[model samples]
Target: MGQGRGAVMAELMFWEAVRRAHDEELSNDPMVLVMGEDVGVVGGTYKATLGLYDKYGEDRVIDTPISENGFTGLGIGASFIGARPIIEIMSVNFAWLAMDQIFNTAAKVRYMSGGQLEAPVVIRSPGGTAHQLGSQHSARMEKVFMGIAGLRVVTPSNPRQAYGLLKSAVRCNDPVFINEHELMYNMKGEVPEEDYFHPLEGSEIVRPGRDVTLFGYNISVHWCLQAAELLSRHHGIEAEVIDLYALSPLDRSGIRDSVTRTHRAVIVEEAEPMVGVGAEVMAIINEECFYELDAAPVRVSALNVPIPYNHSLEKTALPDANDVVEAVRSMFGV
Candidate 1:
């Protein structure tokens, strides 16, 4: 237990892992470069690229003008010309400005060109809410990209997984959408001192149990863990928790395994219940784990209404630990 605790504590912060990934990739491949607003001087809106400018110099760690479409297109163009560009959109909400370049060019290029060209680009963005940031900034747009066939979407829930998955995304041949939860930047966890890469399509069971399966990703995963603790101590229920880090490449095996073992599932998401990732997970469970399930799968998600500015209402709107606990209890009729 002591060793395990120490190992967990040794992990790097999510932002720090991202910075290290960029540094290592930039060093290994001269074609790899970073460009975005404040990435060079301000070290990015979330400081994910801090000190990169000093090491790589201005040419590689570029600070572009406030133009998402222009820089995104420029990155895609560079990729076509043998340069691997890491484009940082300040926030996923801002990605809308570059939709044409992303969906039309980056996503379609390889398929349209019969695999002759690969858009080895990464679009990194800070997404989701940061405590009452309101509707504009808090949207989870992973589902929007789910419809696009060629894009790879990844969202790591913790520091260690964040580092591993981001490294893999950087090296992949396709365009990768790496969504960093705004509230998870400062979170710390044990990442191996040596470099590592998590498979793009794999999901990990963060906690093991037999009573129920609690599925989530990003910040919601943390809440699931909290609810798991409460369920174990207060309700005497052991809830298995699975983090579906990569949203687009759904880890059906992990979801199926957990549901088969527990025979009950409760998916928690910070996004809306309607058309959110939770809905997709629930559907997948219904198809894959329907016979194994002892009770109907459930989803605990944010309210469909626009996020309120009021703190109390905002707290009520998003899925909380209690929501997860109640879902688990309700699923088992306990």
Candidate 2:
């Protein structure tokens, strides 16, 4: 119905969409290239770049040394002079090493240079807890990236979003950070048979309802959807689920419209509660829809602690569908 795909086809996995998008873009442009550790021969730690090395050759599909700041800065420099480079920082935790390049150089270059130059680069990395990675490895750093002044941060919830958003990011004139989830690579969803590029701004309503509105991005979007179903079947509460694919330049109006109709809001996030996405959404609601709300907005977020290596403790640290259901129930005193 909407733009992007010309036809509908079989379900595609998250990584499959990523792979296809890389193949398509690399084949379409000579200036486009991929640079990351293990991306060339090993085909990426998550196999998202499988077969790209053989197809694009050594130059186009480069395997960089184990240096996040060095390779990321190199990619940014390349983008300034008309080259489009997709830099992969194996994990978000490692991305901290490149924070200077990402925040200072890539984000501020255009405005600081008085619009004389732009960094047309895309940084793709997986974040959030997966299995028992724990503590240092389990940071969901989207909030930090979204707070930057001139950067665009996107977190794709499904395969279609993953495919279309990645394509769109490459064409963007400014730097784009794509926060993929480690747990979502094998996730499957329906994608079009043809190429399509999703817009870098705005949000999508995945489910329609008349009661409370649930907002989430990336892995949290699925949790919101599940909560919506539980609310419908168990508590007779119909939650309208919205997927916030675009993290930065958030769709404030879209959230306002949804909350205006539903009259209640529950923001979900996989990250810590303090100064996170949920906090931002709550602030937006308080600012824009304070009069429209029937009660205070609720945030179902991860506990404020290092994600544990123990399986049970790890599960306990994060919010789940049950937590969402309870939060909604508490909103209406049910």
Candidate 3:
């Protein structure tokens, strides 16, 4: 939504958009609190919460100890008592320590309690193989979170989505997990000046075409867009680009609609292919649009090996725009 009449749009880096969202939501809702390591005093590991500590003070923008399980559980518990807490795990790899709180408590509270309880908790974390962060640190664990029942999973690809999605998640009654990319914090894009909420469901058609569908989210979205451009210019093959921002409760109808129109599909991701987003999307294609397809759905994903710290190996382990282009060429037999 372009700013209503007099409202002007401003360009902001992804992290800035996130900080703005946090700042606005905290101001609008007194119950809303942000808790995490360095989130208060240090303004977040990626500076996504920069300057909020002083503005909101220590109580609202409280900083916790390094214990992921302790702080995450504490936030989840507070949510049940009417606190709309935004809990940021410093890194997704560290989230393993908080699985009990996330999967068992926050996710299951509403269902297990028969709607009497609500887990209005938002867990946000940044993950990905960003510039040789190593195997442990370079974890793309969105698939793991998406698979959990009673949990809402979403990943934002740009500054606009980053701002809107976070705002929406804070207000949602169901527990929301926002998987952000490690490398996209400094990425710049236009964001609306006024407050807005991006739906926690549905896929977005970023680019329209008829030949094939390219599905991506987060960092891989840029790859799909780049590949779509090359396919159109060099090969005369128009590829549609779809952003699957919502991972859990995926837009099944959207996938069917796109594949039915294009008759071919290519799912791109920055994670390994096994049991990942690409695999799940391919399954959806087979189940819902198998008869409409002209070719087998393909996936462009990271290699099955652990992400190496060495720069060359790290680059080789991940799929890129060229990989997406090559996959599209193979589909078209170009």
Q: Is candidate 1 or candidate 2 better by lDDT?
A: 2
lDDT of each: 0.86, 0.93, 0.93
Tens-place lDDT digits, model 3, residues 1-334: 3222355678999999999999999999999999999998899999988999999999999899889999999999999989999999989999999999999999898889999998899999999888878889999999999989999999999998999999999998999999999899999998889987888999999999999999999999999999999999999999999999999989999999999999999999999999999999999988998999898889999999999999999999999999999999987888
Q: Is candidate 1 or 2 superior in TM-score?
A: 2
- Maximum-TM-score candidate: 2
The most accurate candidate by lDDT is 3
* Candidate 1 lDDT by residue in tens digits, 243-277: 88888878888889889999989998888888878
Q: Is candidate 2 or candidate 3 better by lDDT?
A: 3
Q: Output the TM-score of candidate 2.
A: 0.98
Report the candidate with higher TM-score, 2 versus 3.
2
TM-score of each: 0.95, 0.98, 0.97
Task: Tell me the number of clashing residue pairs for each predicted model.
Answer: 3, 0, 0
Model 2, CA-based lDDT: 0.93
Candidate 3: regions farther than 4 A off: 1-7
